[model samples]
Target chain A: MSERILSVLVEDKPGVLARVALTISRRGFNINSLSVGPTNIEGRSKMTIVTELESVEQVKKQLNKLVNVIKIVELDPDNTIESEVLLMKVSINKETQTSVIEKANLSGAKSVDVGQDYAVFELTGTSKELIKFEKLLKPYGIIEMIRGGRIAIQTKL
Target chain B: MTKEKLSGAELIVRTLEHLNVSTVFGVPGGAILPAYDPLYDSPIRHILARHEQGAGHMAEGYAQATGDVGVVIATSGPGATNLITSLNNALMDSTPLLAITGQVASDFIGNDAFQEAYTVGLTISATKHNYLITNAEEIPQVLLEAKHIATTGRPGPVLVDIPKDILNEKANWTEPKLEDLPGYKPTLEANPKMIQQAVELIKNAKKPILYVGGGIIHSKANKELFELSTKYNIPVVTTLMGRGAFPDGNELCIGMPGMHGNYTATTSIQKSDLLIALGVRFDDRVTANPKFFAQKAKVIHADIDPAEIGKVREPEVPIVGDAKSVINGLIEKLGDSEIDTNSWLNEIKDMKENYPLNYNQEEKGPLKVPYVLEELQKMSEEDSIVVSGVGQHQMWISLHWKFKSPNTWLNSGGLGTMGYALPAAIGAKAAFPDKQILALDGDGCFQMTCQELITASTENIPLKIVVFNNGNHGMVRQWQKIFYNHRFSASELTHHTPDYVALAEAMGATGLRMVEKSDVKRVFEEMFKTNDRPVLVDCVVDPDDMVFPMVKAGGSNDEVILNEDDLKNI
Candidate 1:
């Protein structure tokens, strides 16, 4: 089944998240990535939630029942600008530095900094792009990796 | 007169002020920014909590302590969700609280809008009433209704969910004056025939017992209860919530009756021929086993909630009304019945003598909780209030502490909430600044909401906290030791606890630790002498100690586990 992304706008207040999460839980919906942040409006905030559901229509109907929900939009990935960031630190010797730099540059990555025994690379792109970059760099000993979950914003009309 | 439009957020503040809510505990978030902006300049004081869950507990503590409605505000989504535990806590304890949360804008109601939640539906079962306001104009009426529902008729928590758009939108607002609401009427009068029948049963019964619950204090019927108990010479048994309903040292007072109840109290309840249960629901913890509780007795149950009248064991005479009013009626009907219970009182006195709360300890061992409680009772005035969190310490306080007046012992009885003591102590201190307030807390319970010590310090409320640092969930551990064959699974909690003295000093308060039993008196003396800042006495207790005379759930009240020797006699 294809993954669904839902954008929900709500008033900022305490206990609202609990109410929504509990509602979704009670409805047996498993949320994938739920991100909430303040909106441009002073008193409003928005939540971008992604979930795998049986039917998009059923999810839409359930979203409508939320008391604090002001708007709900099911986004199509093709029309939306979605990006995720990956911060990976890898161990590299002086001999392999040239090859690693070449590979990193090929993936549109930047060498952010170098530690005593490791070098950190910053990568920002779609989830698929980040995964592909990780696969190419797997030969180089990767020590630690931190990935920011997907955050999406719709493109202008 | 000319009027101006106000946002729903502004309306909520005005309504709260109209309802006489001077203080609220909450955390600000995106969904509730509008309300915070208005609140920034308002007369109401909002305490910002570190977590949304903390806000809920703080409100619960405040309400439980003051007997006034506690109010908590949180923004949409997670903020609202975090309050579930607190709401459930209030619901179980029957504490009156008003929880307000901001929701997503109305226009985005169903379109998968950000932070949108169906809070009202989620909270319906936990709250007495819940409202989701789509219109800004309805804020005033909704708040008033919430307060009214919360304070009247078996007081409990209520929730008000307002959409962000509604809060930001301009609307004409007016405070509603009438206290009455349509289709909402609470019973205040007792059933006359039932009251008469109860009086008759009380007068003729050879062994009669008066079982009181939190309802007596809620109804402010202590004087009436005392008068009736004294007039009829009937002994009284109180539930944990009803600890201070009767004078502690009263001759006819048996003790608290329930799961961890005193053996004398439970025995008195079992032996009574007539049970005049007033303002009590006979909760499972109190009754133990419904079928066998007060087995030989005919029950005359009087309560404000009609549903609770026959919810457990059917009452022979059920009077549905305010406890104070029904009790008053009972007193009026029994004008000088001159009912003597010297023999019954003697029997109770014998039971108390035989099964008194006793714990074995060396003279120089760690401080005993009961000793600290006894000292606190001796130090404070008769009207001083004692608040406690749920655990072994709470039961210890209920069993040992002496209360001279009603509503003097506030506890999270039904809810059994840990981390309730410190906040509750602050609330009680705030409610009655001049009166002494003490919090009896266990180590496990105290750490849960110890952050409230910051509130106590900042607010400068001189509340005393006596921490029974047993270093484990004592009650649960005790149960495992007894009933579970000492498997000790998750009950064993061994962690490096914070240095309470350093914690108190850091929080700008006085802290004392009593490791040796001999030092208890001196430490208590210092605590009682200090009047400037709140004091924390970390009294290290015996880890192996257990709260005895506990009746297992589903067991008869008579089936209590006393010290081995006492069990042999029984």
Candidate 2:
């Protein structure tokens, strides 16, 4: 299956997210990732969902049936602005600490905290950049990793 | 409008009154007691159902019969959960039903308090739209919105779950502004370009069929459908849900199409050159195998919901709009461009004559379900409402009964929920007190929601219920007989205890049992004559009797099994 990103505008109400997610996942579409945030429009929230779907058109039509969903737009990876925040703690010793710090600096990661054997770095970038940076940290023995799901917006409209 | 302090329960009752909801079917419980208190003093009459499921189905029945929004109320937890079946039934059928359920106290909602359940979470997927009301002030707006959503475009069940505390809390009552829901606007008018395309297809098609669905009844477009069918001399085949949408007695009407559908209707649809599908989702029951369904037909599908337009089979011309408006669009565009289809009509007439829906009733043997239905149809008024339970009896009624008007036939079409007939009949009777409401049920189906008979008896709602007691799940047994080498495993009712006649008497309804074939007409006549109270006639029919004109599940619609000869050939 191919991954498709959908930006849905819905009413900012309790259980509205559940309704949308349930409507999608119930139809057997696996949700790869989803992020929700408040929109500039009052009483409305925007949800960026990354799903592995055979036909996103069918899902859009189903989503449109929900009373809370105001709008749905597919985001083209080529013309869409997508980003997420990643917080990673990497294991480091005296010998590898310098190299790890240098690599993290090159990847635009800020050292949020430093311990004797561990370094906590925070980064914000496109999912592609984050994946690349994650690979860099993997060599340093990642202690833990957490990334906010991707949020996208169509750049043109 | 003057603002007045009102409790959430009061607000609900007042809003219902404001919306012209004269009747509600429900059973009160702990959480919903406050609403009942207000209801006791309101103009809206509440019919107390024995169970919440019965209430929901009754509401659905009322909606289907009258083309009006039906309301059902129940308390939280078990009460709300029980309504799930009915909610799903309404959802599948596109019935305009509003289910108002009481929730646990707002403070104890997540605590899993006594008799508390996550009603909204449970019903979110089942309902068209649902609201959980915790704030007293939100009651007016949410209720109004719930009603609007349930009754408007692509009508379906909408639920409003009110917390007990919210129901008790006081709030100022004023007519809240109906929010403009940008997400929920249904396309009601057909695109002009698409209408022109449909017209062109109609002009070119030699063999065309108006494949009608329940949407016609929901949209009150029976007149439009009739006009179009007659004006074009096109034959019509209605789905189970579209039973009475077109008069069954009309020459152009070729009965139902699908599994257990008429031979002529099924074959005609399979062989048609063009199908002008209106308000119908080519359901699997209608088009057994989508790939092979209407192999020759170029489909022009019209429906209010965009999702259903291409959910099954992609049409050559998909028109997303209300059935009535779409038909009007087609009529406006056609503008006296009628070509001749006499040859096609003659072919259909030959098909109808050669393959008519029939059943054998031996004079010396036990009564048959079809015979009972035939007699009932003959004895009942033309405007009488016929509701059936699922299985053998349902198929028999759909095939045998000659429906002459829209909204006169009601059953659990989509979900095929058994035990739907009695309560739905009660609901229909309540809505149209002047019309005769008949509940035709199978022995297996009748027992599921038979408890609702008490509600009908107590509420003084008279209904004529005919239980086709064949001593088994007739449809299942038929399948076993055909597919499983006659191995009737758990299909037969062991002993068939609780004697339906005695049970009927215990429930305060007149009980009658007919075992002989000759007594079919007399028993029906006697039952119809007694109209003061609910009457339950247990018809003892041959258990081996099966519904014919059967298209084996997942089989092609063209391969209909007409009788023993057809089965032997297969």
Residues B211-317 of candidate 1 have per-residue lDDT tens digits of 99889988889999999898888889888888778988888888898888899899898998999888787888888878888889999988887657665788899
Model 1 alpha-carbon miss at residue B563, Å: 0.9
**Candidate 1: tens digits of C-alpha lDDT, residues A77-122:** 7788877889988888888877887788789898999766678899
True contacts kept of each: 0.00, 0.83
Residue B102's lDDT in candidate 1: 88
TM-scores, each model vs. reference: 0.76, 0.97
Q: Chain A: TM-score in each candidate? A: 0.80, 0.93
List of clashing residue pairs for candidate 2: none
Give the DockQ-based CAPRI class for model 2.
medium
Q: Evaluate residue B24 in candidate 1 and report its C-alpha lDDT on the 0 to 100 scale.
A: 90
What TM-score applies to chain A of candidate 2?
0.93
